[model samples]
Target: MATGLLALLDDIAGIAKVAAASLDDAAGQAARAGGKAVGVVIDDTAVTPRYVTGFSPSREVPIVWKIALGSLRNKLHFLLPGALLLSLFAPWAITPLLMLGGAYLCFEGAEKVAEAIRPHHTEVQASAAPARDPQALEDEKVRSAVKTDFILSAEIMALTLATVAESPFATQVFVLAVVGIGITLFVYGIVALIVKADDAGLALAREPRPASTLLGLRAAPAGAPTGGDRALGPVTQAFGRALVRGMPVLLRGLGILGTAAMIWVGGGIIVHGLESYGLGAIGHTIEHAAEAAGAWLPVLSGAASWLVTAALSGVLGLALGAALIPLAHYVVTPVLRSLKA
Candidate 1:
């Protein structure tokens, strides 16, 4: 009886250790995935707040909630299964597909840059831009954001899968689930905080604690509006003002950076793919030369790879995107026009 009980205890202890190891793995993967998508996460957060900008106060949070739910759905429902299938049967296709998505990201980013440099008749955005009706606009924004999220999520999952290429199928699934849920929570939670920050600032400005209009403060009520909230308190007020003012600029920057990353990352993928198919000599030559030059400091080899690959990739993507742009404009554009027509 004692022997059987001890065996049972040993099994339980082993299972506990396995569960702990799994959790640790999941946490590590989440951190790595988060680091990988920092650029997209910034872009996502920056792009999202604008969707709630023109809405009424009461509707802002609700719309944010809707978009957050859509983001969750994107990661969990659609992307999860699709990514698993790709991993299983079409793993080889992942990089090319990612490159395609990356190209689209570059286009979107470049378009935004063009918009900024060009004219703006009104603060109003494009014609197909979001609506004002809370419900309608919420639905539209969620749909658009989810579409965007799917691309980013695919990248995240693909990267994670690559990292865990040799793991068991069940481990891959569990890690993916953890990554999806963790990233969704992190991204959307930050988005929520960002969207509500202005309101929070306004409230803090109005309900000035102990330190009132003494050092030149503005007072009202808790959660009340203060037009002078821009320059309310001394230090905190200045910080808030700066943050609020910088939001638009940061968004534009994020857009630009995201596009650039897309091009660089996409170009790298295509270049790597080319090498995989046959043209490996080019990559081999570069890598070998880099390693030789930096042989004294082996640590810098990884940096060398990143620099060589990223630079080559960006150049390649730009040339490719530019080459395709005209054809896209003349042929694809007209076909799209006719289809919509």
Candidate 2:
């Protein structure tokens, strides 16, 4: 009886160890897959904050929370299962679907670039439309944001799936769940923080006591103090003011970065897809150029090569996207309208 009990315990211990190793493998795969989808993640983060804009301070966080829940539902309930099914049955279709998504990304990125250069009449009119009821507007914004998030989430999931395509089925599922939940939390957490940063900055600027007091230092006498008795209130206020001032600039920068990432990543995907389809000539030429550029700067060769590849990819993306704009506006839109009619 004693010997049998010990064997049972040993088997349990071995099973536990296996489970632990499996968990670790899933984590590692999740991280690698998440890294591959970083471009979509960035664009998601950048695009989200705008949905909360124009809302009263009280409503901003709630709106973000609602949209976040919708985004989560999109990934876990819809995209995750669909991706698994595709991987299981239609594995060969993955490359073509990914290429289509890449093309969409390029179109979106290029459209944004075009808008920045010259806003269309309809776009201008839409922006100038009179405000509706606050609740209505808020609902509309959340729906719009969630709809946009679905497309971006699909891209993220597709990228992640592509990364783990060769992994075990269990590992693929685990990694997908981890990446989906992890990215949703991370992206929305940043969005929540960004949209409220100005409010935080304002509160900080309005601090009644010197920050030094919080640091366990005595508050200096009224008016600026000299020497070791320096007060930190003004410095704190300045930093707060700077934070408030910088938020707009930061948002603009994020938008620009997101747009560029969309184009570059989309272009890179198409180039790779073409190579996979045996049309490697374009990809090879770009790689050779990158390699030569890297050779010129051996110390920074990796970064140089990556930058060169990305630049050429962006050029290809912009060209393709530009060519597709007219087709989309003139052909696709009219066909869709006619179908609906």
Candidate 3:
């Protein structure tokens, strides 16, 4: 009886060790999967802040939090399970679905670029609609943001799924869960900080002494001022001023980067999907060009190859998106409008 009990204990220990190793492997794979979806992640982060743009200062963080929660719900509740089911049953559909999502991204990115180059009369007219109450506006914004987040989250989750397609089903589930939670946290955390940064700067500019104290100054008596207090105020205010000036530019740059990233990622996905379908002419041409560039720049071969590929992808994405814009405006939009009617 003693020997049998010892053997049972040994088996339990072995199982525990295996479980621990499997968890570690899942974590490593999750990190890699998340890395592969970084482009979509950046686009997600960049696209989010605009939703909170017109809101009051007090509402900004709350709005961001609400949207973040929606994003969490999108990834954890919807996309994760849907992706798992698709992976299990309709594995072949994954690439085509991903390409569809990629096309949407390209369309969105190109629309933004077009708007930047020439203001859209339709958008201007739409903006002229009667304003709603603040609460209603806020609700509308949150809903819009959430809807947008759902699409981006789907793309991110799909990209993650593709990266881990070779893993066992159980492992894939574990890895995807890790990625979804981690990415939601990371993206929304940065967004929260970004939307509130101007307010934070304003607070610092208005009340530099307290800001200085937080920075490292020892607290002074309730009525008495410290010597360091006087010295830090100007410095803090100046820093705050810089931050205020810099934030708009930073946000604008992020918007541009996000748009470009969408196009680049979307184009790459479509091109790869074509290659998989044996329609590899465009991809082959790009690859040959990249190889030639790599040969020419021996020292920076890898970087040159990547740059060439990225440039071509961006061009293709832009072209495709431009083509789709007219189709969407004429056919898709009209159909959607009619359906709604």
Candidate 4:
């Protein structure tokens, strides 16, 4: 009986070890998958802040939290199951679906570029429109943001699913869940910080406690005037002022980066998908150009090659998106309108 019990315990230990290793492997895969979908993550983060615009300061974090929950629901409840179903039953469809999502990213990025070049009249009109009821407007904004988030979330999940397409079923599930949850938390957390940064800076500048207190410096001489009056207080206020001034610049930079990342990532996906479909001419040309560029600078060859490839891919994506814009404005819009009619 003792020997049998020892064997059972040994088996249990082996199983436990396997489970631990599997979890570690899943975590590693999750990181890589999240990295692959980072462009969408950036765009999502960049896009969400606008939804909270015009709302009172107090509502920003709560609005973001609600949208984050909606995003989470979209990913875990809808996209994850669909992705797993496709992976299990129609793996071949993944590439096409990814390409479609890539095209969408390209479209969105290009539209932004176009709007920057020439402002849309409707958008201007909307900006000037009269305000609605605060409660109703907030609800509308949240719903609209969540709806937009669904598209972006779907793309993120699809990219992640494609990344883990070859993993075991269990590992795929683990990776998808981790990437979904981790990315939702990360994007929304950064967004929350961004939207409230000015508030934080304002509070810091107005703080009654000595700035030294924040840094663990010597305690203020028994109730000394704080904020800009105390030693290092001016410095703290200056820093806070700088933060207030920098937030707008930071947001604009993020917008630019998000647009560029979308085009770059989308174009890369389309090019790779074409290559996989035996339509490798464009990809091959780009690859050769990149290789030539790489050969010119041996020390920085890898970086040069990657930059060349990305630039070429962006050019391709821009052309494709520009071509689609007219089609979207004309045929697609009219068709949908008529269908609704």
Q: Please provide TM-scores, in order, for all candidate models, with all chains considered together.
A: 0.73, 0.89, 0.88, 0.90
Candidate 2 minimal-lDDT segment of 10 residues? 224-233
- Per-residue error for 41 in candidate 1, Å, reads 2.8
Residue-by-residue lDDT tens digits, candidate 4, 96-157: 99999999888888998999999967436777789789989889998999999899999998
Across 71-90, the per-residue lDDT of candidate 3 in tens digits comes to 88999999999999999999
Best by TM-score: 4
| Alpha-carbon lDDT, every model | 0.67, 0.90, 0.88, 0.89
- Ranked by lDDT, the better of candidates 2 and 3 is 2
Residue-pair clashes, model 2: 0
Which pairs clash in the backbone of model 4? Answer: none
**Model 2 lDDT vs. the true structure?**
0.90
Per-candidate clash tally? 0, 0, 0, 0
Model 1, CA-based lDDT? 0.67
lDDT for model 3, please: 0.88
Give lDDT: candidate 3, residue 156. 89
Candidate 4: C-alpha lDDT: 0.89
Error (Å) of candidate 3 at residue 129 is 6.7
Poorest lDDT segment (10 consecutive residues) of candidate 4: 220-229
lDDT of 1 by residue, 8-66 (tens): 99999999999999878766765775665555665676667777777777877777787
| Candidate closer to the true structure by lDDT (higher is better), 1 or 3 | 3
* Clashes by residue pair, model 3: none
